[model samples]
Target: MEQKEKQILVSIISSIVILASYSLYVYHKFMAGNPGIINDFRFWGRAFLILIPVAIMAQIIIHIIFAIIHKIVTDEDLSTKNDERDKLIELKSIRISHWLFTLGFFLSMGSQAFGKPPWVMFITLICSGFIASIASEGAKIFFYRKGL
Candidate 1:
């Protein structure tokens, strides 16, 4: 209906899609005996490069869905509609994500002191970092919506 509503819906759906895909990838890797996504960073790097188009398409889809929702809700032509609050929330979430990732990286390195395989620690750190970042952002959004 409203631009805000459309944006919120699009954001939620895109997040769900991304998280689902990532979970499936993790499950597939586990079934294939890889057990960890980043254990094969070389392969992941190439795959990530090749999947850039998919990522772009996902973004485009998110925008398109938002546009459609906006049209349906307001019966108005689609136009860019964003506000400072949205941007501020996104920026803060990204900052938290970065900090979580950095902490995870350092923890992975610290694992080396305990004689763990570098690859294992690295992969574990990456997975944990991603999960933590996503969880943190989700919590932030939840709190924001709950009037925290």
Candidate 2:
């Protein structure tokens, strides 16, 4: 297979693995019966403050795994870095992300007409928009590289 095909396959596999791990983590958390939401400022502080580092670490690890896979599968040396095409693809991906985030934000706002707590709706919208942006970027990169 071509390098592009290999890269696309690796991207799909990596995405599936990361998503599955996240799903399992959520399931485990559910099974452990964590509180739905700690309304207390002290508990929320401790919980999300600790979680920020954990989330960053997880992203680092995922990037590392992608780097390793690219090194193994591609002819070019790993340190031989991103080219013009890569930058263009990334730029396009960011444009796509913007649209996705806007869509998610507006959709979430529309749902708030049902009269939920403003904070809850706002936070949910933010998180969903963030996820949608990431997913849109990924899809844009894959499609641009793989030509589909």
Candidate 3:
């Protein structure tokens, strides 16, 4: 596998781990104590706000760690340069991510319009974001493998 592929795989894995662990932590820390908290708009708002920074920081740290390990194992630096093909692939993947997130946003709003609980909408939104991220990375892998 190429270095870019390896990096993408690492990103995908780290994202999944970060999201799952953070979710469990939040559930146990807050929702587990009082299930009613799930219905609180403030709780959801705070959770979303906190999750953004936490995810960003965690991703940066995980990537940094991966870079260090990769260097140690391979004795070579990962390429940071992007050629035309790489840029094109990235653009395509980003388009996919954007559309998926847009759809998710609409679906979440639709759920609320249909009388679903706020928590349902929030969960839908979160799932959509996660799916979009995974799909984007998957697309990059596919494009790379297919020589796009």
Please give the CA lDDT of all the candidate structures. 0.63, 0.59, 0.95
For candidate 3, write residues 18-66 as lDDT tens digits: 9999999999999886999989999999999999999999999999999
Q: Higher-TM-score candidate among 1 and 3?
A: 3
Clashes of each: 0, 0, 0
Per-residue accuracy of model 2 over 55-145 as CA lDDT, tens digit each: 5576667666766877777645445356777667767766777777787777668767777545455456546645665575566557665
- Which residue segments of model 2 deviate by more than 4 Å? 1-16, 30-55, 69-76, 116-127, 130-135, 138-148
TM-score of each: 0.59, 0.56, 0.97
Tens-digit lDDT string for candidate 1 (1-148)? 4445445556656766765686577457543665554466666555446445665688688788777876797788765655676667667667777777777877787788778765657466646555665665575565357533
Candidate with best TM-score = 3
Q: Is candidate 1 or candidate 3 better by lDDT?
A: 3
lDDT of 3: 0.95
- Model 3 residue runs over 4 Å out of place are none
Candidate number with greatest lDDT: 3
Taking every candidate in turn, the Cα RMSD to the unseen true structure, in Å, is 4.4, 4.7, 0.8
